[model samples]
Target: MSGLVVHSARKVDADGLVDDFWFVADDGVIIATGTGIGWHAAAQGPGRDVVDAGGHWLTPGFIDLHCHGGGGHPFDDGPEEMLEALATHRAHGTTRSLVSHVANPLASLRESLSIVADLVAVDPLILGSHLEGPFLAPSRRGAHDGAFLRDPGPEMVEELIGAARGTMRVATIAPELPNALESIGVLIEAGVVVSVGHTDADYDQAARAFEVGARMLGHAFNAMNGIHHRAPGPIIAAFENPDVTLELIVDGLHVHPKVAKLAFTAAPGRVALVTDAMAAAGAHDGDYRLGGLNVTVRDGLAVLSGTSTIAGSTLTQDVALRNAVTLVGLDPVHAVAALTHTPAHALGEDHRLGRLHAGYAADAVILDHDWTVRRVFADGVPSADPHCTPARFRMRYSFCQAGLFAYAYR
Candidate 1:
């Protein structure tokens, strides 16, 4: 009979926007949602706690489809470090995440995947593991170690799949690799959502991967071919595929604001905002490691130790949401959808993970009218205040077709 009910709020989800919204959840699943004072009757049971949103921005908790680590702990380190990283993102309203692993030795990757599988078995918040390397193109390896770079050979793919033990939800493969077209089919057959990235694939080559069931484009415009008049490349191929989702990192360091806005216009509901964060995310900037490579994070920009090669990121989903509205000129409702529903769809988990409808998870991120995360509720349990503070918190306003967008930094 115990339940958590939130009433009188501005809610945005699959239904777009609903003012004076209310939803009641019991045993970690939403049982009903309505408008005005409708939640009163549903929340009459014992052990009920009601909160007045007062018309603040309330949306579903973010789902990070691609994230390495945070809170000064790398997902590749071990189970404890992975849990710590999970905690860090959860505080920032990422209720669910996939453990992303960079290129590493097969043994190391297997161990990490095993650890992730163990955690996913017990933690519903852990979506599963994502293989971002070992099957990548060496020429566009970005921040991954080159030594472990290899083609998506069937034997290697089978081994990693075995290591993940049914917990492998997503992987990025370069379409230009030998046997990659067939590998994409194999991965899809194994229930893994395949993405084409870290590739030197041309437009046709990328199209071939999608033809074989590649459902996502990994961190579009980063570590992949750019849009050339003659060579449209994988990004264009992804844009053409209606079923594909494009992952974007809008931390201001990885992409230009204008280009990011183009993604929204081109793909609409298909763009998923992923942090692609390393350990420095939600933690102090300094030295960190992604696999065996040394990374230096200064001013929130993470790069390789001795070169200008961009590393992962120091971004959380909340900051990405704000940047989407303010910097990228996206509607607040659309931006929230990218953080919640789109990513969940990418993993085929939207049935229960995304949206604020009945039978969905009781996870919600309550934000102030200014779009700042005031609190987060996951599994019917509330969180402490969001530990999200970027280096600068200036209020910058940008007028676009989406109206006046406000940013936390200039």
Candidate 2:
């Protein structure tokens, strides 16, 4: 494609926000970004479409590292469902995501991996697969099928890894399981990011997992132990480990805002805001299935039929960003980073997927003054239909420069 110029917006970079700026992108790569009227005047050229931001916020596109499903579809269903779920998220500003699947039978897991691998071959927006279970602690396997939970033994781990065919980006496991440490070694060696989650592991065990090459905390504090004076728990261990990136579900129901603020303050840029959203994320309140488990969505909250335990969130990345700023008291810049750059870094795709830097894909979300999505662009093309409406297109771009195009329009 040809170059496009986004002018007259308040630009936000990795460092901070700037005003009176213009950004240029050509063939899906950001070519130039500068502030002041001179840059805007210099940017005028033939065949360059200019989008006026009207002084609204301009940041990088959001990324989600841990999301199960959306748009009334679950990831465990198959490629069609996975694609449908991803489309729901993409309309809400998530340009790239890792297809997360819950615990299931080995054959089912293999099939899911194969489907994801095939999708990745043609869709770069599907970062990879996030195996969220089958190697987790049953006691803490919140929404995952406990019947399928198993120890991450060498053979089973190798089998699952091989099934991914090098397309698996992350796997969540309990650190205290048998051979879990060894499995971490194997997974890290295979270039997969290991995340500590769904476990009864205390401080020491969680710390050991981090020491053993686990670099992420899945939905921190939801499926794990809490912080205590003596124990400190996995949350503290994650906070203390600078290399670890903590995932937080900021839907106000999954976690208290005060606690979420504490996590943001404790981890700083290491916090990655994610939507552990299930099948009912973008749908109306009704019956749904998550990982073969019956779930009911009432009052926009997804829960087990008879229990208060949150099955998943009815959230999208745009709402997560709004909550991060308004509810969690996070700065807009850091909030955007948590939703975009941090998760991209976690998946080891920062070079091509996150931020608005040159050579990155032209995936973007345009928002209004109130942070509502107005327009969404995936792979340098505007999404055919967006999920929400805003006053105007404020600047927010999420790019995945690879060959895959997997964004959805509501």
The C-alpha TM-scores of every prediction are 0.93, 0.92
Candidate 1 segments exceeding 4 Å error: 388-410
Candidate 1 local lDDT, residue 244? 96
* Poorly placed runs, candidate 2 (over 4 Å): 37-47, 388-410
* CA shift of 410, model 1, Å: 38
**Would you list the clashing residue pairs of candidate 1?**
none
lDDT of 2 at 165: 94
lDDT at 285 for candidate 1?
Answer: 81
lDDT string for model 2 (1-410, tens) is 66677767765545577777666777776777776665555356766767777787766767899899988888899776787787778778888888998899999999899878878877767789899988999899887778888989878888999999999899998999999999999999989999999999999999999998999999988999999998899999999999999999999998999999999889988889899999898778999898878898999899887888789899999899898889988888888888888898888778876676667777767777787877666666555245542212212222357533353333
lDDT of 1: 0.88
Please list the C-alpha lDDT of all candidates, in the order they appear: 0.88, 0.82
The residue-by-residue lDDT of candidate 1 on 2-64, one tens digit each, is 589999999998669999999999998999999988888877878887888989999999999
